[model samples]
Target chain A: MLDYKLLHALATVVECDGFERAGDVLGLSQSAVSQRIKSLEVRLGQPVLIRHPHLAPTPAGQRLLTHYQQVQLLERDLRGSLPTLDDQAPRLRIAINADSLVTWWAEAVATICQEEGLLLDLVIEDQDVGLKRLRDGDVAACLCATPQPIAGARSVALGEMHYHPLATPTYIERYFPEGPCKASFQSAPAIVFGPHDQLQHRFLAQCGYHGHFPYHLCPSSEGFVRLAAAGIGYGMMPQLQVGELMASGQLASVAPGHFLAVPLYWHFWRHSGQLIQRLTQHLSRVMT
Target chain B: MLDYKLLHALATVVECDGFERAGDVLGLSQSAVSQRIKSLEVRLGQPVLIRHPHLAPTPAGQRLLTHYQQVQLLERDLRGSLPTLDDQAPRLRIAINADSLVTWWAEAVATICQEEGLLLDLVIEDQDVGLKRLRDGDVAACLCATPQPIAGARSVALGEMHYHPLATPTYIERYFPEGPCKASFQSAPAIVFGPHDQLQHRFLAQCGYHGHFPYHLCPSSEGFVRLAAAGIGYGMMPQLQVGELMASGQLASVAPGHFLAVPLYWHFWRHSGQLIQRLTQHLSRVMT
Candidate 1:
């Protein structure tokens, strides 16, 4: 057995690069840090340091420090996820993309946990980046498309969301008047869910029309769908999100057969974790 | 969040059934368990039980209880493995099978932890059932062939271990100079590692024989290997356990070109953790 408390002190010293500075972080005297390190080596029954005026960890000590870092990360995640299990008040923290948050995704997240009694800390950003919150120790888990296992984390696939080239029936009729999709879409003004979204470009590439379109950058997802429904321009939208508008004739998909599709995936830490798994379960059922 | 103390108390109640018996086990008044359950539901904002003369948990309550049981098992395992990290000489608790303890496996386990500065407590039982020690909160983890994933646990395939029929070359020559493996084997005693071991049965079945072997059960892994080495009787042994003996010609494998390969998997609670992974790393390198 080794003294991790002393090892932690040693790590702090290596991190601070001075005994006095390490003592300041550890709230110990410089002499105490040095004494602790000495005692740790004795207890290990092995020399674990090559002490110098400028503090540095030995090979064995460095290995112990790496273990210490992993333990620290695990402890932080446990602390964040188990606040209520202890004397502390419970809080629910979630990391999700802005597009999903602004769309119907929040409604799904809210429905699952609201009645269960917890305050949620919603971390909203782009889907591509928001998922890093889980890895960076900012949140317990996240929803992402990258899909590869995150070291110790697990992922479940949520099915594809089809996004067809959509526009208002009148916008299609009046703008072209050459009937639906007859006039090339290469010159149509398109609505974007966000500046980062490339669905329109992808659709045009598939249509073999490499020409660019004038874009309306409506960052909000629901707003983009509304702009298309209001007959402003053509945009790709998921059927689940726009079926009612399509039914009411406010929006008519342009060449409904040609659609863009993106598959979604949910990733989380693999544990007997009720919260993350339950949330993933509900979202997968509804999305798929 | 669920109250762990309450769930444990409820489990105690279910195990005992009567409130007085449950109280005795938990060292609380019967009234305390009842009050605890009431408060737990209020705190969680969810009903977990409909108390009667004997308690029966609701569906949500059962799920919560199961999670608590997993937490309890991991906590116990942590306690056992934690002492190993302390050079101050805290009580060391280790989980192992009777067969391994009797065999060279115990020696390996002892030697591996000896220089590491651990105060050891080794609990021994049959490998097939020693896992109950882990699940019931007795030991940290054990070497088990159980392939099913236990709640809160993970499994890794350690690879196949080939067990061949072996005996002292002298004993084989003296007992039956000419092979009448089926007829002579029926009369010759077989050395069994433990009561539940299937190697002898499978071996005999291969020779078109049935019924039980005239058995001498040595319930220790190292002892089983040593017994066969001493010309005690013919028995099946793992290649890793007997590979050195075979190389030295101290033990000759009777079923030379034929053997049974059993793929052993390592299972341990996720929280009990990488200890099992470390063991698997060492065992796989040699076992294969």
Candidate 2:
């Protein structure tokens, strides 16, 4: 029930960071772009953008952009299927987290892109926030940690991302020679992915360390593992990644029988596109 | 010219998400926390908190939080140096990008943390934005790409992170048998790190492909290289990382002689702490 042109104008203004630049991209005059955004705002009866600090969309504006992106995706998909339309390759926008992108997901996605002659635009975010991007319509599909499906969306369980408390043998010997007790756990530092990443906190809380503890925040999975291997801090590591280190005695388990298993899901908008179907099939087949 | 206590109150409220919870964390009543925030808002003569769409700090609020965090870091460092200070290890926050973290940076950092009995809180962001954290006082120091130093900061040129456009030979033959041209560049997919990452764009622009092109976004350096090796897409890779692979013929340069040499600098507050000095010395010695 909204105008695609107006919605695009709004999204482009945010993306371009100025009306003049958005105009250049959309082939409209600066005033025309401004007027289109103004018209859209009037239609919605609310402001869609915050003008200062940076050109960013308001919640309502984000919702509108999401709608626009969804419509654009479906239309593009439809156009790709109709042989009479054009031979232009279709671009597929996807939302994913850093962890999945680095591990098993990238290979599967790249193979598909090459074979199908599809263009992929990947929006990388934390798994916790990946689904929010999907809800906002910033990306047509997302791989996230949330197991529950959003309304009018389809979700497929991609199995658990198992994490165990791992530390270098030297770090364990230096900090927890008596094993990982509450006392040593408090004194020893832990590595965290980011402020929002609660993997270490969850594991510690499960191990009964409820109070504030020292931590080193390494925001990348590979970097975090490298730090853990170098005796910087004890933190959780995925089973697949830590197995070799554990076997080689470079890294050791902090606590026996205590692990955090984060369940992951792939969520996509309710659509009937062959590409989406094939992508889903390919992911489900390979991820498990 | 701002009260650190009030700023702390505001930051805690934003971090904790509710007045009651923030009050619990600060050991104050909910009304006290609210009154402190109100007083601070009055002092600033601007609304600092957004009451709707979940609790978020306004631009002004974010600025105050940055100041508060900076003050907190200095105070903690000061206390750690005092003879009366407790034996608890101090946390040192820093800003860096993913590539540095995954490569040579992590080892040196972990060694410093282990030796100094300090906790590192690394804020990972692109080199372009890494200095912003230093200005905002979110981190005491940052590893960034900016050659010019901010006010009251000292910069040390470490080295250049040289990147070359790399891809598998098979992909090169299939996509660009005629060699690198604007047409082949348009049709062939390129791997990008993230939406914010412009390495590929810079390279393409250098190669005369000024328009938009198909791309696969792989957020990790390691994963990006994996995709390139698997013939998913040609992307920029650091020379140090791709050297072995290139030697083995698993990967080859897309366009020889065309590379991006990103000069990296270490920027830090003009502080005289032995720990900061030692850290800087250690990093310069290792990275250079």
Candidate 3:
């Protein structure tokens, strides 16, 4: 059996990103926090953290952290059954893609969270990489493009998020005067969400343009759409996010028929508590 | 003088987060990219990269990268005068806080971007830590709470962002039936943006509450507002973001008169090109 107090100190250190901040949160001195970490390392006979350039957990440290988080979830379940436990609400950390959060995710989970008296810690990542958060045990659940679940985890298919290569009417008239073609695509600028986002690259490939093209990288979902609408660049806009804009003629598809349908999946621990299970079921129903 | 080609390789490696991807983007073989990095390091007589765990630049590498990016900016300015230079639009990377991005940022720079035929790479970061991006050579400019600029950079005041502790009427009725007091604040849930966000803690301190309180950690600016309006938790809502909601009677101030005024500043290199200077002037005029 492991000492939960020591594990908690490790978790807090990672969560706070420093021993000093962890001490502030845990109501202990910085040296005391350091002492606890040292004691845990002494017990385990290995270092759990890489303390130089940046504070990150080692592989062994990650496994222990994941175990601690899972135990915390089970304890929350136990607290639910026993009304004598403190009435503090439990927080569920989820790694979700930005497009989902900007469109359907908040509304889908809002009711359940409010009813269950649950709190959330939402970490936004690109769909292509969100699964890593689940795999690393950094989050209880995640929404990603990948359907495969890691060990001790389950994945459920959510519906596809259709993306259209969209731009303002003025932008289209200026850049693609003869309509979208290989030549036009090579010249016209495009908006990419970030380095991790491959939607535009894939969409362009589907349009038969594999050559290098210029692009603006905007990390914010709202800002990406706004840039496209302001004639800064055309981009692959998610259907759920741009439906109203498309209807209002604010944005028009640069490629009329060609679209990318990215399939989303919900991944969570197989042995998660009832709240997570319920939330998973609810998302599977409404998301599709 | 350092070879721009080698510096370009270094920048591409960091940008892509891997050598293979950087090779693909640079149209070089993986070994060629590796050779370029090695040659650059040999010339410098020190290691530029820390390859294990993660790919990050050493201090010397960061200095070289910053110098390379500044030269790129100057070359872009030179291209404007030369006109015969390939007509690729210059891309300016800026680090901005989510609140500013969500509210005032895009609109402030949209016209300038469109007119200048410039593209943007906007990196979203918390205001408290955004200046680090600028200092680390990751961004050409940054919007942050810090008033002082780093060496070779300039800082301009951009006015204050007022944050009010806001909650729905029903949430207030349930959590603080009488009125907001230390006891209510102790038990009631709060919405914090992330670990770096201290607005709520500062606001609570001002309200005469210095005890530990439960909070939901939300990293997205739009989602944070949604969570607050959904009645998940009361949070320090930015005045620019919640004005419409507050006026429509959806969100109300919990403490009535109390608010947090976080002063914002724009930090950029002192020797930037005309485009950056124009942007600085534009932001100063409108953001205030």
Candidate 4:
């Protein structure tokens, strides 16, 4: 029989699409990620990935991932459940993105505790990272960014987290010397939240700029908003993600009507625990 | 950390409802059935059953049984698949009641082969026994008598298998002998398919007859019909099951319009391979 722990490791590696990144997400070493995938392939006697095109999972890999996703959710639900029903509240663990957790998720968890008498634990990470936690047996549910759900989680398009390019007035006046680059400046530098995410690059690429930004790597969604607000550089910020800052004019929209829309998606473990249902019901209310 | 396998065994036992009968249905010794359940509770660190009131599974046991049912279907689908995709015909495994296997299931399988290039491994047994086979991982799909589906399987009401209590006209004339004793004579000696099944008994029990019938266990559906034709005993035979014998006047309806109707249900692996889909589709046509 194949080692289950190795399968879990391989699953995380595929989700992250890079050995080092997957290791970072799963709290393992790069060598450990590589070794686990290697061991899993040796055990299943099949190549589970072609390992290109940004790490597409092979059909066999997809099948195993699907099963793994399902089993992981069930196990999480079981763990979160009260053992055979008791007087005490069940421990409810939820995986959620930094944006939602700091925004409206706390209210949702509070409602559940007050109404249903649930004990809650929250994991606040990036949307993409929250999914990794859900997959790695860390939490019962998560708020994700992508519409396409990670293998086993059931996803609903909560709503898009709309973004508009913004910069401080001084920074725009100094750098652009123009409101927003008219017809795409191929040579302009920019700031971005994280290393792997290319949202800013993609937006610029749409206008023919192919160069990377002198990036800030502000990991948290709130930190990214703060970095953009301080006018370190022109960057993309979600409407809800940076709503108050934009309204206060600490950040100004550089591109008046040209903000690239990054649609946000909420994914939770498929019926894991009562707390997840409570969160999703609440998130759905504000997300739309 | 409980023996998940015991949940499986308990599902099997509860599905069949008797240790010895469940053993025969599962192809295990009665002692093996007891041992499997004992080991399951030991693993679970809890007693799963109270051994009374029709042997109910504990709440945890019930939940695990539901999961086991889903797992079994997924496992069957996985096993039915070939090592690699090829243009060749795929083997399909199905468990069907003897009456259905003999009457309509063959034509349905033939139709599936013609349309989908399927190779079938047909399992013939009683409907109750077929469900047990499904529970034990014997077949990828089954045509069962019960309307309720096994945990992971999908079910459809395939209408009724109209049965007319049949025997040589001479047997009714001799047994009844005179008037005013019709219901009394109907509950007399009967032909049951096998020691494991109680279809005939159910019919009598429903009619409020608490007495046992002096019986013959013919085992095969065809054999049961033939013995009924020759006047060995009265038995409920499906219209498709004894249609030709009745046409030839070799078997005449002993009860005529008063015979009981036994409904047949289609149960297939919820995540079945291509063949199960094709076969169940055709069965809806013939059995309906």
Candidate 5:
């Protein structure tokens, strides 16, 4: 059987990003933390970490960390059933897209979290890649655009997030004086969420403009909307998030008929405890 | 002189996270993109990237990237002077902490961005580490807690962000019925931003607590406030961000007459062009 104490040391080292910080977190000496890692490596008969350029876990280390997290979940389940074991509130580590977190997620999950005495460790990732957090065992559950679940996990459709190509009226007048067309799109600046965000590119393609365009990359969801509302750039604004701005006449759709509806899914391990099950149900009921 | 075309290929590959996407962005075939990378490596007489585990630049490659970014900044200055050269707006990549981004940054820079026809590429990083982005040449400027400037850079104090240990009324009633003390803090949950965030820890230490305490990690600035207001956990919240919540009776300080003031600094290259100069003037004027 594998030693959980050693696994915990590995997890803490990776989490803290160095042996010194891991020691601070674990209340162990720096050399002691290093010894624990070495012991784990010897027991496994393989090196678990790459320590040269930066402290990154090898594939073997990642698998062990994942296993440790799963075991932690099971232990939390046991603790839930036995109240005398520990009175500490349970923590649910979840990977959620920034759009959802900014829009409906907090309001939807707030009640359940409060009532259940649960704490949250939220990882904000792009919808396109949020599922990777689940696959890598960095999170217990994830809300992502992908519908397919990895092995041992189940995915439930939460609903769709509709995005429209939106810009301020003055911005439209300035950039698209002749109305949005191929030539206009080539010159007009767009607001992209990040390098991995393809919403703008896809929206431009839908408008029959498949050409290089200049864009401002704002990683924050709130910042993205602020940049658009400030007339800095046009971008794909989610209907759920931009309702207030749209209603205030601060933003208008550049493309009248075209919209992108991305379906969101909640992915969680099938055997996850009551908390995951409850959250999944809550998300589906509220979002759908 | 180094070939700028090769450097552009390198930057795009790093930005896109793969050669295939970089090719699409660059309007080149996948093999052609790969060939460009090879040519650059041959010219340098060393491997620029480690492609196995993930595509990451070597230290030498990083220096080249930094040089390329600096050159681009200089070129943008030249284009600003010669308007007919290119009508494209200049892009300024900046690293900013989430608290500033959520509280004052968007409003402060919105007018300048709109008027100057400048585009922002904002990277959200913790204030403690934001200077590293500036040092690595990933950003033109950065807002961080560090007052010390690197070589060729100037650091100016923007203002102070005061953080108070806050919690919802009901949460305080449940967790700290006898008022906040070391024993209560040991049992009561706290909301932390992430591993690197030390605000909560500092606040706890100030409150005369040094033992281990449980915390829920929430990375989003807006979400962190929401979590605290929802009665999930107590946290160190910025006064700028929680004034409305406090006014509404949703949040209140757990510890009276205690707060952490993190001084904000704006760090930028001393030799940057007109746009940076204007921004620096605007920030110093408004923030102070």
Candidate 6:
């Protein structure tokens, strides 16, 4: 049988970036932490981490970490059946992108997590990176953009999030009075979510404007909408978010009938309990 | 002089994560991209990147990438000085946190970027992380929590962001009817921005609750506030944002006399021009 303390020590060191800090967290001496990792390495017959530049797990260490997390989760479930553990509400950890957190997620789960007396530990990152956290067992489930499933995980399509290129009427009048063309699109300022955001680029690419054009990055999803509505710059906004602005004429669709749809998927561990089931059911109801 | 094309290739490879994708970006064969990197590495006499896990630059490569980015920015500025380039307004890139972006930044710069016909590129991250972007020359300036000045950069204090431990009256009654105590605090669900968020922890520590208690992660600052206001969980929120809700009794300070104050600073490149200076002045005026 593998010693869980060694596995915990390894994962903590990788997360903390070094043995010294991990020792502080684990309440052990730095040398003690090192010894534990060494013991684990001896048993596994593989070096589990890279020591230079930064402390990161090797593929073998990653596999062990994943196994350790799964076992811990299962143990929590097992504890739930004991009368003494009944008072401790099971906490559910999830990874999700920032946009979803603001748009609909908080409102969706506000009741469930509260009413059920369940705790939630959310890890927020970009959609792609969020899945990496899930695969590494940092989170039990993830709402990701891609549909690809990891080992021992199941994925469900959450439907496409449709994005429309939109701008204020005044913005359109100032920049694209003659309607969007190569020159107009090139010269006009645009709004982007972040550096990794490719929606604006993809939209412009479809318009045959592939050059690096100027843009204003507003990282807040709601703030992006507000900026676009205030006539700062044109941006791609989800259809659900832009509906009111479109009706009010605060935002006009730049490309009518053309939309970029990003399909999102919900990925979760196959052997989940009441908490994950409830979360999945709630997300399916609200997201769809 | 160093060939900028190779520097660009190196930076692109790091950003794109592989030679194959970097080749696709530069419209070169994968082998050719690999050869260019190898040549550059030989000339530098140091390996610029780590080959495993993911393609990330070593410290040496990061230095080179930073230098290349600075050179590119300088060239863009130089290009703008020509009479023929006068019509093309200079684009100013900045890094800021999401809280500032949504709170006041988008509104504050909306007029300047639009009326001045200047483009603004805003990169958002946590305050400390944003400063890293400024140091790496990804942005011209950054608003950071730390007042520490980077090499060749000037920094000014921007005032403090005060946070109060808050919850809805109904929530307080349900979770801590008597008042916030160690037991009540541990049992109550808390809301947090992300893993890096420690405002809630500090507040709880002040209240004598230091153990690993339950928390619900709401990544968006606004969403965090909304969840707290809706009785989902108590959270630390800025005083400016909670005023109206507090007045209406929709939210109340859990620990009335306690608050966490985070001091902010504006940091900019020492050798900045009209755009950066104007932005610095504007933020100084508004943030204070």
Among all windows of 10 consecutive residues in model 2 chain A, the one with the lowest summed lDDT is A83-92
- Taking all chains together, each candidate's TM-score versus the true structure is 0.35, 0.89, 0.94, 0.36, 0.93, 0.86
Clashing pairs in 3: none
Question: For model 4, how does the per-residue alpha-carbon lDDT over A1-288 read when each residue is reduced to its tens digit?
Answer: 556787777676764456886786567899988888877777779976665313545556666765675565455456556456333334345555545543444444434444554444444455566676666555566666767777767887776556677877765676667654543243233545443355776677665665423333333454345444544446777676567777887788766777776655667666564556666787677557
lDDT by residue (tens digit), candidate 3, A67-102? 998988888889889979976677888998888877
Worst 10 residues of 3 chain B by lDDT: B50-59
> Which candidate achieves the best TM-score against the true structure?
3
For model 5, the local distance difference test gives: 0.84
Top candidate by DockQ: 3
lDDT of each: 0.59, 0.79, 0.86, 0.60, 0.84, 0.78
Displacement of residue A200 (Cα, Å) in model 2 is: 1.6
Of 2 and 6, the candidate ranking higher by TM-score: 2
lDDT of 2 at A212: 71
Interface DockQ of candidate 3: 0.61
Per-residue alpha-carbon lDDT of candidate 5 for residues B1-288, written as tens digits (9 for 90 to 100): 888999999988987878999999899998999999999999999987767445777767777777887787778778878878866677788999988878788678877977877788888888756787788777889999989999999999999999999999998998888887977898787989888898988998898888888788888887788777767788998999889998998999888798999999999988877788899999999897
Per-candidate iRMSD: 34.3, 2.9, 1.8, 33.7, 2.1, 3.4
Question: Compared with the true structure, what per-residue lDDT tens digits does model 1 show for residues B34-139?
Answer: 8887787887787766453124566566666556655654554566668664323222234544333323342343333333322233444444565655555444
lDDT of 1 at A168: 72
Can you write out model 2's per-residue Cα lDDT over A110-198, one digit (the tens) per residue?
67777778777666676756787777776778888888878878999887778889998888888998887888877888888865677
CAPRI verdict on model 5? medium
Evaluated on CA atoms against the true complex, candidate 1 attains a DockQ of 0.01
RMSD of each: 28.7, 3.2, 2.2, 33.2, 2.3, 3.5
lDDT tens per residue, model 1, A127-232: 5554655554445566655667577778787765678888877667756566334245644557665434668778877777665455554444554565566455
Query: How do the residues B5-81 of candidate 3 rate in per-residue lDDT, one tens digit apiece?
Result: 99999999988878998999999999999999999999999988878556888878888988888988999889889
**Which prediction has more favorable lDDT, 1 or 2?**
2
TM-score of 2: 0.89
Model 3's chain A TM-score stands at 0.94
Task: Name the lDDT of candidate 1.
Answer: 0.59
DockQ of each: 0.01, 0.56, 0.61, 0.01, 0.57, 0.53
Residue A69 lDDT in model 2?
69
Cα RMSD, model 2: 3.2
